[model samples]
Target: MSGKIRACYACQRNGRLTCRRTRLGEPCLKTYPLECVDLLKRSRVAFQAGRTLKEGFRLAQLEAVVQMLEEHECGFVDALGRDLHKSTTLDECLMVSEPLGVVFIMGNWCSPVQTCLVPLVGAIAAGNCAIISPSEYTAHTAELLHRLIPFYLDNECFHVILAGANDLPEVVELRFDHVFFTGNRKEGSRIARAAACTLTPVTLILGGKNPCYVDQHCDIAITAQRIAWARFHNAGQSLAAPDYILCHTDIQAQLVQALKCYLIEFYGSDPRESRSYGRMVNLEIFNRTRDMLWRSGKVAVGGQVIEAEKYIAPTILTEVVESDPIMQQDVFGPVVPVLTVNNMDEAIVFINKQEKPLCVYAFSKNNEVISRLMSETSSGSFCSNDSVLQSLMVALPFGGVGASGMGSYHGRYSFDTFSHRKSCLLRGTRFECVTYLRYPPYEDRNLSLMSWACTLSQRSQGWCQIL
Candidate 1:
């Protein structure tokens, strides 16, 4: 209505939204947050044009993501460090691979960049338009993505939505072709429910209290080092990180000592001062972790907390009962509780009693012990003699089961998650007369011939092996 202001003509004309903004004399530096309707319109238009159906286009977009990662590697690392107090020296990285049509991806603050972009890659590969709604908890990384994604990706097909609390209400109300979310069970359930309202299919990459079973036959030293590195690397904020340990009582004391030794070895005598050690992502997580730690159990190894710096030492709690506060829920922090079981059977029973986990890690030299656990468990994944290492293998699917979450993605799995698997069957029309053998009269000779035709035997043991 004034010289300083003008209605958002682009949104008004092309989208089901009315956005008014001021046209400053100079280049406007402010990012105008796209309305839910506007974001949907752009993606829908791209989807209808079949931009995603081109295999060449999908491959190019995938290449572009790799280029984006390589070109802006330092910037992403810096943002991760700023947001999660991540250690740059740590060489480990996590990614989830997938794609979908006019998709909405809601990432978590824990592994902000990886959780968001990995799925985006899958979506792109599957030839789907996407709107990435990054976690507000990691504001800096979100801001960087907002600026960088458009520069590398096809702007008409991809978008980064960054807005305040009020923006979310409108988002869940809009319908999407698919919704991919990664976060806690509570929030993940909420997102799934919201997606259901629109009759939209959803793939929830959720978190849970994954268990690590330490058998007496395990190489305690190696197990300890691996657990310490895996659990505390990202301040224990990883969804797949071992949440707690169920150790054989015979080796519980020694296992605790070994774990203590490794934590100090990996981080330092005081992890807070160690450059390799990480801190809590923010004050809210710090406080939640502190409370969980306080009520968890007696701190057997490290128990220091510096809330001001959002630091929680790589802490292990012993003398923890199965009914303890920390044991009952997912402890997504640098704090793990170790509980002792009389034997492998006790450990198995304890694990079976709880909700299915994302992963169940067992460390043992005994092949039988490993086999038993593998057969008995019902997790999305299980790793014997290792911890969360399978996630790095792009060939393997990364996801959870039951209460942990549903669906999976990584490499081919990611591509499949975003792409519909339509079954196609083709038959020769010239063979119509032959089909009458099994119809109408349905003679015993026709049945015999049909059965014989379908029957076959193995050519070799390679074709059919005894389990």
Candidate 2:
């Protein structure tokens, strides 16, 4: 059998055995699958073999990881296309590398190329092992990862686990050095809890109802077009994508009209036929988003769904109330809600009331406005006059706060995550009178001298202190 197939079989067998063992308390022959055990053994051996952090990884190793990612990228795209009927942009695929001993739990809505692969690459470049648990909603992508990892990576050093909701507790209990998760607030909490039991450091990348604010002074055409692209990209299933729009009431109508034009231009008159648009991952998610659309608020643009195909058309809602389902939820599918506000202060206030988002985007040329927003709102990252692109920067720290998530990693940050920084101090052999004074002495003269010496030593390193 091909290596990929063998790896796939191994993962499948292990997953079944793990689930069965977890649920029934059965005595399985293996505590973990052979592949997992082998990988751990190899990693431990590598660590013990005097492989310095710098020497543990090689450029060739990174290249190999990239190559494997590329090999699976084709399969991943095909699988995701089959699952969602939408292919991710090329910029997304270039991201996956290897693990720096930090694993990322990717979200279903994330493009396999960027969200799943790139973080993997970041970890690998940092010379760490990674264990990816892809979103269950994106089963095909997850399966592809299970197959490709062992084929491309050293089976003894890199691994992927196919886990379900029930297997989460066991997976989290493994005492991984670091845990990186991308999902909703509820599940993020559960992952955090599991990591806490082991005191494992965690990096959570979660967001809720991110806002895109447009000032009246902003360029309407550029603002609307960027907003439309950000809001509708990957059918609006991005953490950093604009969740809602806040604009000054004076320019709200104009901006909304411009946005409508841009949406039609980007996705065409019939977005259902647009190959660029993607579908919801599964029927459950489709129904959940559909219910959110039907039960709450007003639909200003598209609210149509093709249930059999699990498709929700590019949608835009206006005047959505805070109590509306769309407002309350993360809206992981392609649906944009636009809310009009009086000014930047009101917009800031509105954002402050909700959970801190993974990303906050503001479109304004004014430095003061950008400065004020940056200073006032707390987010994992911020994009001024742009959206979703901030995460692409390798130098910046990427993570969330409060309910959104925690920890940050990108570029060297990934290296730091997997590394244990130990401090060592060497004592010198030089002896002096000060050292002798520290010996036992209870006599008045010695006590007085010791006290005076100590006082002098506190003032300066001098001969008086040596007395």
Candidate 3:
């Protein structure tokens, strides 16, 4: 029964299905614990039928996805709010034979909508059937996708399933051409292990403690404002949020004061009453974040927590050291710890001592400081004078390094991710005389000729390389 189908959790009890009619007046049955085996078989059949291979059909499907998003924009916005209490917000070469058949996409609570659909777009663009599983934590968004995707895309080629933690192992056992996952390290490891059993390719867009360095040479006020927004946006349930701050000891107090002033300016004197801020996803996340806030250094700014609302105020911590509990993991919350470094060198050393982060941020007007940070340190991505905005540009590839994650997808990178470029060499028998050098009758002259023909040089119009 195992096949290419993705599954996510809405908690076992929350798995409810409702019947609805499609735009064409066709009855769409939403079933719990979907007939995964049947669904995978049908999707495989559709792929083998070659319906998705045509450029016209692929383009049509892509357009339908856009139309669906445009028509259901309000529904998605409301669903996002319910899920996280927050707000808004490729190409190939050679033969480009076809897609990697069926792709299983499993997303997490962080940016549930984007994580699920962005990969799906790539899969569809590359002509692959997909099974999407939105994060179980964002049940409302999951349910919304479950209702909307089938209505717009080809039902036989696309399916959305809502499954719980208990179903994860069984669903992942299904053989798929590719598997894409986004979440924390623990679950990522589990997914990787399972995919390895079948030798299936996997793309992991995981999270880590992204670091931000506040240089004394830069405008503390501007730096403070930018960091505050990136760190606290969407109530800080962001994977790209600045997880911690490493600033020069000379301007530590000044930086802290500037951050406090801007926090007030942005969210008001009391953020709890502010409409701009958001809350944690659930009780478990709230407790973990709240505990980090208390166990870490003394709060320099906002540190209020309301369990009922799952709200953790936009907070900054002072007197923090590297050994603190909050520094150990990605503080996927509104709270950020500020650790002081004697100089840029100290900050660089401190940063290098830890696991490579998803992003390494530096705020400095001096180009040398920015250059030094860019060259000396390594992360999934690097940005100067800003935070998470580095990943926003479609032109750039976004992913992580080391424990952060591997593989990147954005714009054309996404298209390439789901595509299997089938190499085609349409050789003709007319060239048999020239190709005879590669035959079994090897000689020094033939070897020399082959090497000369294959070697690339700087004089060549293409990329220069040594053969």
Instruction: Identify the leading candidate in terms of lDDT.
Output: 3
Per-residue lDDT over 1-467 for candidate 2, one digit per residue giving the tens place of the 0 to 100 score: 21211223343444332444435655444345456646655766777674534433676677788798778888966765565453211111112334335454444446654556666766676677777777777778888888988999978767778778557757887888677777778877888899899888777777677878899888899998888888888887777788888888898778878988998999899998998888877788789889988877688788899999988988878777888888888878788878888889999999999888888888888988997888789887889888888887888877787777777767777566555554333333343444455667567766665564444322122222223
Clashes of 2: 18
Q: Superpose all Cα atoms of candidate 1 onto the true structure and report the RMSD in Å to 1 decimal.
A: 26.1
Question: Which portions of model 3 miss their true places by more than 4 Å?
Answer: 1-97, 441-467
Sort by TM-score, best first.
3, 1, 2
> Global lDDT for candidate 3?
0.82
Q: Model 1, 290-365: lDDT tens per residue?
A: 9989997899988899878999998999888877889877888999999998899999999999999999999999
Better of 2 and 3 by lDDT: 3
Cα lDDT tens digits for candidate 3, 243-356: 999998899999989999988999999998899989899898899999988999999898889899998999999998777889987788999999988899998998899998
> Which scores greater on lDDT, model 1 or model 3?
3
Please give the CA lDDT of all the candidate structures: 0.80, 0.73, 0.82
Clashes of each: 5, 18, 3
lDDT of 2: 0.73
Q: Which ten residues in a row have the lowest lDDT in candidate 2?
A: 87-96
The C-alpha stretches of model 2 lying farther than 4 A from their native spots are: 1-109, 431-467
Give me candidate 2's TM-score against the actual structure. 0.71
- Model 3: lowest-lDDT 10 consecutive positions: 85-94
CA deviation > 4 Å runs, candidate 1: 1-100, 163-170, 427-467
